[model samples]
Target: MSAAAVAEQDGRTGPLERPAGRTCRLCGSNQLRRFLDLGVVPRCELFLTPEAVAAPDVSYPLQVWVCERCLLVQLPPLFTPEETFTDYPYFSSYSTSRVEQARTLVEDAVRRLGLGLDSFVVEVGSNDGYLLQHLVRRWIRCLGIEPSVNVGETAREKGAPTFTEFLTAETGALVRAIHGPADLVIANYVYGDVPDVTDFTRGLRSLVADDGWASIEVQHLLTLVERTEFDTIYHEHFQYFTLLTGQRALATGGLSVVDVELVDIRGGAIRIWARPTECAMEPSVRVTEVLAAEEAAGLHVARGHDGFAEAVSRVRDDLVSFLIEARRAGKKVVGYGASGNGNTLLNYCGVRPDLLAYTVDRNPYKHGRYTPGTRIPVHAPERIAADRPDYVLVLPWNLRAELLDQLSYVREWGGKLVFPIPELEVVSPAPADRPLEHPVF
Candidate 1:
């Protein structure tokens, strides 16, 4: 069967009717070339109870394709936004580093935009109002639009004026009617989650003042391929963007890229500063330079997506092999951080409790639950010291530095750290007898 037919059969259409073919979401092109397939996996966030874990969980094909015409890499929506985001479990405030990053961005935006009490700031997908809390503290007028009722209520309790509704073009108009057009709109790491990119950008354009700007951050596709960060691919993330694809996606709503900032957060993300085409701002030279780099790296062609499957396969093999060896050697191996991406990696590698005894998470909500698909028990970080596993596999490799420091006590028991991305390697502690030549992983 054709991809389009399969998608239609699976009930993947958005509110608007997609073109007949499996068209590109950005440019409406009919040329989408499939590249990497991660096989079928369960929803990343479906933490199950011991009773539910024994029952079969739903799974969907986790295949990715790049649009030949627009270079937008995306996965077909196997599940709807309402099915994925409503009553969401992932909260942004759980990570101190992430909260600090949001604060820094809010401070920078305030200083750069000359925001004051009169200025209005609106954020889409504002999870628990992590960023809006900073704006409220400055006594600035701000609002948060979040679809998840649980998180939105938490945001309201935190004193951020939040509306529990998805930001569609219609909702954007309503916001403008009541709150007025915002001086600045912020969408952090959410552009990939929406199924309708055009509608989401149109909503941004509708909500922001003509002279105001919208800042969006998305995981860089280049980094995904280069670092083999396939674990980031889950059902919740519908699209991936290079600078070229991002510009095209935004331009669909008459927004133009004004500036670009490469951030180290989320393994390598691009923060795009965009303004309506009517807002007379020149595009930054950095935008041109980044596009040049992408073109030079052949990101404009399908061949750039080649070899990604092989790279992912190698990581899967090496990680499984390492865990098997550790088990055979009678060493206890446990995972740290029961994150969504970690679930993807574990499910893809077929790692179960036999290979990895359990995983620990700092998030209280995830603690005492079992990871989706793998059924690995999730425990509090305190369990790690009590258990003193021989090897702690750090699942969220992007936050390795923070996790390693927080878990430094593991070294006291001669425990080693293991990371599964880029390559699977066991990081040994620095010898106490000599000064370390490199930072401890």
Candidate 2:
């Protein structure tokens, strides 16, 4: 094929070729190896506005590589923060679960850290102040470092006291001059979105006080590989992290991890707590155990690569087969949860409105908008009742249990629920007043 044709096929700005000479992001090693190449895909958080939808869709190549030295799994060269974060549309306040989770986290932090009026809490990439708002109400002095102007303004209006600029070393220095070091730095779900570990962590170290702590929530790479959660591999998520990689990167930036907690909030998450050297808490056994696991799993080398790719193939075949059979049987099928994972699965598997009429989400931002590349229209939860589909495909399979519990009303019509990941299963919802025998997932 011509170079232009290859570039189009790869969904990148240039031709498909191996990155040369440059060492790994964590460790300066040239032993990097190729892993999964997800082809060209659109940015996961770039939710299309109505007007933008009428224009051409922008897409880029999404190829992941494994750093032989540090075992960090990350995407190849892509856009910078300026290009990606300007007027970004994804807002955290849109989700009830997230808001509640943030509130709980703030409350827990206050109790655990002995945080009170004297402590200052700082949040990185605090989108729309979902977490900081909780701190504000608790009478704790908090500042939110947000990049997106639209999201930052919205949060400021909500009284988050946010700064509408990217958090960098220079920005951190400026903020420190005004507010001094912070007692807490929240890097929730924003760790993976950042491409540069050196810069981001340096900025984090500077903003946090000697006695302060930093808590970061990142998606577990182990879960991604084990569960075949390929849908999480999108443009926005620059890296899929294991504890080993995270620790190494943090230590290099003069921060030490004191604790690591496994959380169920976002599919599978690792909430890591860190502080400066003198105030560093002893690293938890979980941290060492995870690193050992990754080492044993051969994550540092190009191993277990085939199984993941094979699993993706099986999922595609199984889903397509199931959909065709259901259509042949004259069953109306629809999808649920118009999320980033859903978008990746739909676009990669070539699922469209034909196989599934539409998808639903609780977030209003995504309601009237369509999925990035697939053009699958997003509707509110009420549409599920108005046009009752025979089978509802749970795109965000991680939250299947929660969605099923809330959508148990569909069982009144004998409609069944479907989970495409792990495996496909048909579940009949329990009566409205009755409890479900099986959990939501």
The best candidate by TM-score is: 1
List TM-scores for all candidates, in order: 0.92, 0.89
**Over all chains combined, what TM-score does candidate 2 have?**
0.89
Q: In model 2, which runs have C-alpha deviations exceeding 4 angstroms?
A: 1-23, 47-56, 300-306, 431-441
**What lDDT score goes with residue 191 in model 2?**
79
| Candidate 1 local lDDT, 249-348, one digit each (tens) | 8998889998999999878899999998998488889999888878887788765666678889999998888888778779899989989999999999
Per-residue error (Å), model 1, residue 429? 6.3
lDDT of each: 0.85, 0.79
lDDT of 1: 0.85
The best candidate in terms of lDDT: 1
RMSD of 1: 5.8
